[model samples]
Target: MNEVEGRGLCLHNNSNGNLITPSSDDDLRNVFHQIRTTKNPAVINYGASWCRVCSQILPSFCQLSNKFPQLSFIYADIDEWPESTQHIRYTPTFHFYRDGERVDEMLGAGEERLRDCLWLHS
Candidate 1:
């Protein structure tokens, strides 16, 4: 079984679903930069507190992260970090980055898409 599967993460539309009050502009940049430093692929879930899909699927995302320690997982609150990801057109967006560069992306918090994203990168 794949690592994600081993952790009980289903890569299907099972739907899912951070608060950082950035003290200053530098704090926001630093957080972004820190996540970008991972040599392995990084997964960021851009979600909102009120999003139902996010609520459903977030546990799976965290399980996948735990199953694969080689990758970094970051969660962003849309309300808190508008400037950090303003270019995004959708909520509950999943992004995969490698060495500070985005290598893959998925839209929505559906299980199928998330499975595809993690499988594609994994």
Candidate 2:
């Protein structure tokens, strides 16, 4: 998988949170592994490039990364991970992970709602 900052899903301690984009299934697994090992809270946005709602919330998602440096923000295109993301039933689905376990999930989009979710998770 092609990563902007390579290993650890770019979720390592940093001044600003990173929005990781995994290129392959292996990359996604590696990312999760890092999250699990580090026990860092993470948010994965499962969306499709062609989905209008996905496009709308993505920019806000990126901006939130800057606001919540403590959280790992990841963007996963459902199409790119067809096999790995088969359970995803909605565009712009968000999965929240903490202590290597998935704790919550949200589907659909709204900037304010997303910001609130991030705040709660962060």
Q: Quick one: best lDDT, which candidate?
A: 2
Q: Which stretches of candidate 2 lie over 4 Å from their true place?
A: 1-17
TM-score of each: 0.69, 0.85
Candidate 1 residues lying further than 4 Å off, grouped into runs, are 1-28, 35-38
lDDT digits (tens) for residues 1-122 of candidate 1: 12221333223322121212233336656766875674556677876666778757777776666555666666665665668767767777888877777887788777767766777776
Clashes of each: 12, 0
Candidate 2 has a TM-score of 0.85
Model 2, range 1-122, lDDT digits (tens) per residue? 23333322223233463667887988988888988899899999988767888877877787788888889988888788887789999998999988988888989999998888888888
| Colliding pairs, model 2 | none
What's the TM for model 1?
Answer: 0.69
lDDT of each: 0.62, 0.80
Give the local distance difference test score of model 2.
0.80
For every candidate in turn, the CA RMSD to the true structure comes to 8.6, 5.3
